[model samples]
Target: MKVLTETWWSAAIGREKTVTVVLPPSYSPVGGPFPVLYLLHGFGGNRNTWLQCANLSAVVDSHRLVLVLPESGRAWFINDARGRRYEDYLVHEVVDHVDAAFNTVPTRDGRAVGGFSMGGAAALYQALLHGDRFSVVASNGGAFEAPLREGDPYEALRGDRNLAIPSTRDHERVWGPAGSEVRRRYDPYSLIRNRDPRHPIEVYLDIGLDDYPRMISMNRRTRDALTAGSVPHEYRERPGGHDWDFVDAGLRDLFAFTQGHLLSA
Candidate 1:
């Protein structure tokens, strides 16, 4: 596999962004167009997280596809009140750049999105919201649960917040304080329920058996929501914790699932 670093301008977020791309050994412009899989990184991670930790290149090498790993920082791939338009950049800017710069099948059927942890959630969330742009999604240990809930007003969090919570400040900054309208719009349950049955978005979600109780519960709730909503998806519970180990496990199979769907492109 061949890996390349790219730095480009993104007006959506009003800043430049760096992306990591991987190409299979047989990749070449002359080889014809190939499908592309876009990968997002979790909170606190940059563009290289999946490549370094998940062995993404090796796992998906045989698939003969293009892998695009774009950095999301702590933004959760959403447009926050702080003016960070990561979601917009991912759906438009990043994808546009890849398709123009690489030998890729530039269509909905040619695209797939996957991520780990916070990114996993972002992957599925973005795919659900923009099904016309992405046809398949694979989330490994995705943080599907919303950080804030209804009735939990953002104004109420002005004083004394719990520091023990994981990235509590970021959650508030990105998703906003509880009861934020964006949260409801981005809510997994609501997104799953709102999906049009006539157009199906293939989904693959998995969480470690040893993940935090909250993580496991949220993933279960999401899986149940998919089942109840009649959204086509594959769910799995594997042995591992919420680390790179868990993300790496069964990754090949997930890639295979992605490959199967990409064939139509």
Candidate 2:
């Protein structure tokens, strides 16, 4: 696989953004376009997160596909009410820029998105909100449920001064104050409930059973919501935790699913 690190100005956030693109050995800008997979990073992570943690390079090389990993900081991959339009930046600017600069398929049928943790939630939100832009979406150890229900372990973490919740400020800025209508609109449960069942997007969700209690609960709740809505999806609970080990364990299956869908699309 060939890896390219690039930086370019982004009008969406009023600053330059960085991204890492991985191309298969067979890729040639003059030969043909290939399907693209957008791999997102979680809170406190950057564009190289997936490349460094997951064994995705082998997957790309073997499948002869392309991978695009973009840095969005802790933006939650959402358009914040505080003036940062990260969702727009990702769906429009980054997608357009990658397609323009490389031999990408340049259509929803040729695209897939997946991530873990904060990025996992963002991947689901993006696919649900913009089904026309992706053929498949996967989330591993995703933070799907919102509003931090009573008894949620995260609630206690929120109040603990000793713990560092990196997403605190960005969550508020992106979704507005907790319990607001804006938050509801971006919640994965709400999005799934409101989505049209006729939309043709394949969904995959998995969470490590030993992950944060709140995260596991939220992922199960998301699966329940999808089941209740009759949204076609694949859900799994594996014996692991919220770390690279779990993600690496599932990367092969995730990539296989994505590759199957993209090829059939």
Per lDDT, the best of the predicted structures is: 1
Q: Would you list the clashing residue pairs of candidate 2? A: none
- Best candidate, TM-score-wise? 1
Instruction: List residue ranges in candidate 1 displaced over 4 A.
Output: 147-165
C-alpha lDDT (0 to 100) for residue 23 of candidate 1: 89
lDDT of each: 0.80, 0.79
| Cα RMSD, each candidate | 4.1, 2.7
lDDT of 2 by residue, 19-105 (tens): 899988988887668888898887777888887755776777778578889887766677766778888889998888988998888
Worst 10 residues of 2 by lDDT: 145-154
Off by over 4 Å in 2: 147-152, 155-170
